[model samples]
Target: MHGTSPPESQRNLSRGLILLLATACGAMVANLYYAQTLIDTIGPEIGLSPGVAGAITTLTQLGYGAGLALFVPLGDLFENKRLALLSTAGAILGCLGIAASNGPVSFLAASLITGICATGAQVVLPLASHLAVKERQGRVIGTIMSGLLFGIMLARPVASFLADAISWRAVFLLSAGLMAAIGIALWFVCPTRKPETKLGYGAILGSVWGQLRRHRALRLRAFYQAMLFAAFNLFWTAAPLELLRNFDFTQQQVAWFALAGAGGALAAPLAGSLADRGLMWWTSFGALLMLTLSFIGADVAVAATSVAAFVIAAILIDTGVQLNQITGQKIIFALSSDARARVNAAYMTVMFVVGASGSLIGSATFEHGGWTLSALTGAAIGGIALVIFLLFDRGASDPD
Candidate 1:
């Protein structure tokens, strides 16, 4: 805990409490993704043409970026439990709005709202960090993050299956009901921990940039993850198209592939443990190296037309990304306690804002030269991050 103790309800953070918070993160983050896998079907049903169909996912992502900029920083100023729970309530409304959408305009608007509310996951993270003891914070956060990763990995497949069984609307409808239950349960289960910051909302928002500028470690950590995340996004965005085109994969099969790739999230807790043991540099180096190499392996696997190799590449790619993510988050969170949310918001905003570009780059590269070009491009990105780390971060003294 900080100088002030955590609220009574969260003093212990037993297995059950951790599980609930992790589940909450998973469920909230999942909302940002369901629309992504169902774009083709959703567009056709809602009168959105094929050309503009990408807007459905794009607006959702943009909304999430907005929420991170606007709402996440508030976590540093407000009651943690109330802020997270309120965000959850908003997400439930957003989900229901999305479920009821009948047109392109309505669907897109609802998607944006859902994206904004999905920052509940971001809020949950620093809250968990605040509640956990200092020594074990990394491990606890990594476990919670594993749930977030699992949600991302599972959302596409779940959406595809649910849409296949019922309709595209069921995904959001079901999410709404699940969020409703989670929100209600958390109201009783969560303890109140008010933030110590005295800054008003405007000042808090302004300080986000200040923190980024003040902390060299935060910049490098964010940069490392941003690069890896860009590569991660690049691989995922193009991989599905490649599979469908070259491997003759059905939507359901792509879903399964993604589900299998999710196995990498299991390593997040291990990464956290390594960070706790003070092997941050080694962990990050290995992760970046693996990420860089995985793309090359993916290219080879594609050339051989071997699904097994591709699966291996998928696992390595995901593992590298998650491993680096856990390390990066642990580093930044340690940079400041009082401004954890603001610093977190700043770090994440950088990565996500930058990482969003990878999707566009991936789609374009894949379209032009197919998987060969796209995979190589991803490799180049990873290689850059690796070089930067080896040169600057490897033997350099960590800033306080």
Candidate 2:
């Protein structure tokens, strides 16, 4: 649609391209989360107060939200390959800044930049959606999303393990090197996509609000996803603290716990397949219910100090979040062929901002009332999301 180019048949995504996109998504999104588990170590080194240290995760999320608003929409305004490369390059610089930081202020600033640049993952998702045929869109998006979800789930363990083996600074240095490698590979292998939209930058930005107003399904799906993401963030942010305080687990043990949570990545493809079959309503409902139950399970696990129970809860929580996310994305990407990037930007911006607040709330709740309060808060939020979905979203139509 952008210009004279390869026919749709030729442009159909190859296996290699899908793998590349998946890897790119994983690598880029990993940057926003590596610091989450390292906060304990980093805080002492930088003389950060507990309250201020908690802000490390929050600031990264806020930067991601800002990038979703300010940078992700550029996917529609510029060629996809160039846009992705630029973001990745910025991430490399941010990672390097983080590695070299000598104080909390510098570290925090670098984290913000790293989060902002990680929007490259967002760019890759829409580009993948745009490349696939309509009938196979859900499957394609699901596969790529599996990689993104795995990236998110694995970042903590990888960061924690690396931090224990070396130092927190080495984690950032390693990430910077990985970002550079991925950027170079993408430059050579990724397809070029010039979006057909002719709107100026201001016009593109202005259109986001109009797009939201026009699509009731987009609004509903976005709200549901935001709530789910908040719950997701709340659990992961607090779990590490609980393990350390209650179980006396070392960083390596926490890393193993995070590795267990990666089991949830399996749900992404399964949810995508269900969505393709027009089962999003039931799947989403079940996912929300599972999310609620998972938190309850977590509270019980913490009370009894049962590692097995906690592991099960982690799996269920991660699975529920991944299911809802893929299902929601399947619906939103189908709303308009030409406006996928803008619609995605609007949806993700809302989700990340709310999710960031959830991290802050979880940290404070854990500090004051311990894991029980944090778990209950997550359960309550999940219940609220379920109510909203049942009352207003039950009648939502499947994507055409």
TM for every model, in the order presented, reads 0.96, 0.93
Among all windows of 10 consecutive residues in model 2, the one with the lowest summed lDDT is 1-10
Which candidate gets the maximum TM-score versus the true structure?
Answer: 1
Clashing pairs in 1: none
Give per-residue CA lDDT, model 2, range 1-400, as digits (tens).
Answer: 3642335974688888887888889888998889887888898888788888977877787788889998998887888889899989989999999889888899889989998999999999998888887667777788899899888888989998888889998998998998898888888878778888899999988888777898998898888889888998899879989998889998788899989988988888898888888888888899999999999999999899899999999999989988888888999988877788899999888887777677778889999989999999999999999999988885663656
Query: Per-residue lDDT tens digits of candidate 1, residues 232-346?
Result: 8898999999999989999889999999899999989998898787778888989999999999999999999999999999999999998989888888888888899998999
Error of 2 at 198 (Å): 1.1
lDDT agreement with native, every candidate: 0.88, 0.87
| lDDT score at residue 143, model 1, on the 0-100 scale | 90
Kindly report which residue stretches of model 2 are placed more than 4 angstroms away from their true locations once superposed: 1-6, 43-55, 103-106
Model 1 segments beyond 4 Å from truth? 1-11, 394-400
